[model samples]
Target chain A: SQTIHQWPATLVQPVGSPLSLECTVEGTSNPNLYWYRQAAGRGLQLLFYSVGIGQISSEVPQNLSASRPQDRQFILSSKKLLLSDSGFYLCAWDRDRGSPLHFGNGTRLTVT
Target chain B: AQTVTQSQPEMSVQEAETVTLSCTYDTSESDYYLFWYKQPPSRQMILVIRQEAYKQQNATENRFSVNFQKAAKSFSLKISDSQLGDAAMYFCAYRSAGLNAGNNRKLIWGLGTSLAVNP
Candidate 1:
């Protein structure tokens, strides 16, 4: 069985501070990884997705960026955080194009 | 471009009763995938059911089932004997089956519908 792990279940940071959220999957290799954000009582917005290492496709232009350093390790980072950047961040992985996505326990970041 | 639409922002149903949440999508591609994901207050996305465009038979999982109308572009989720645990934000998503790289496997999501189960 495959499992996804996301760190810092809840985060509180001041504005203009740097941010790093990591996600990793075990028991799978060369899986598709994705990062998504959800506002309070709203739908999810796709942030970034990677099919392989060193390859990232961003869905929207924003203050955040994503990277795939290792085959199963994905990181979401920001040089400077904005008030609007605070939300529920989720990491997901899939085996293939037709497979269902498996999500990790999200990180709730609060930017003050 | 493909788009998923869930018109109802919120819906409530009595416990043990049945409820149906509607979803509609627009796509030019013939082969694709549709999914229903449930997000409870915890906010973890849980895949409830999936339907393939090429299949005519509707897909069912335990108490959850989907009414897939390919021609109508409608895929609705029906929950039988709804429970309080079923209360959550339900999202409809579409994925293209194209073999192209980059954006082929990305899921197009809807605004989602919040379901409330009343006892």
Candidate 2:
């Protein structure tokens, strides 16, 4: 069975601070990883996705960026956070194309 | 551009009853996939059901089933014998099956419908 782990279930940081959220998958290799953000009582917005190491595709232009440093490790980072950056960030992984995505417990980021 | 729509913002159902959540989408591509995801208060996205555009028959998983109307581009999720645990935010999503280079696998999501089950 594969499992996804995301850290810092809830985060509170001041404005203009750096942000780093990590997601890792176990029991699978070369999986597709994705980052999605959801606003309060709203739908999810695709932020980024990676097919392999050092390959990332950004869906929206914003303050956040994603990196796939390893086969199963994906990190979402930002040099400086904005107030609009606050939301529920979710990390997901899939075995291959046309596979259902498995998500990790999201991190609720609050940029004050 | 492909887009998904879920008109219902919130819905409620009595325990042990049946409820259907509607979803509609617009796309020019013929090959594609549709999915319904559940997001609980824990904020974990769980796959409820999926339907391939090429398949004519609807897909069912335990108590959850989907009404897939490919011609109309409509996919709705139906919950039978609804339980309190079924209460959550339901989302409809679409993914293009075309073999494109950039974002053929990216999922486009609709505004979710919050489902509440009363005990």
Model 2 chain A poorest 10 in a row by lDDT: A93-102
Q: State which candidate has the highest lDDT.
A: 1
Superposed on all Cα atoms, the candidates' RMSDs to the truth, in angstroms, are 0.9, 0.9
Output the lDDT of residue A11, model 2.
99
Query: RMSD to the native, candidate 1?
Result: 0.9
Model 2, A15-106: lDDT tens per residue? 99999999999998999999999999999988999989999999999989999989999999999999999999999998655778899999
What is the per-residue lDDT of model 1 for residues A53-92, given as tens digits with 9 covering 90 to 100? 9999999999899999999999999999999999999999
Instruction: Go through the candidates in order and give the clash count of each.
Output: 0, 0
Q: Write the per-residue lDDT of candidate 1 for residues B47-112, one digit (tens) a residue.
A: 999999999999999999999999999999999999999999999999988888755658999999
TM-scores of all predicted structures: 0.98, 0.98
Query: How much is the lDDT of residue A74 in candidate 1?
Result: 98
- What clash pairs does model 2 have? none
Report, for every candidate in turn, its global Cα lDDT versus the true structure.
0.94, 0.93
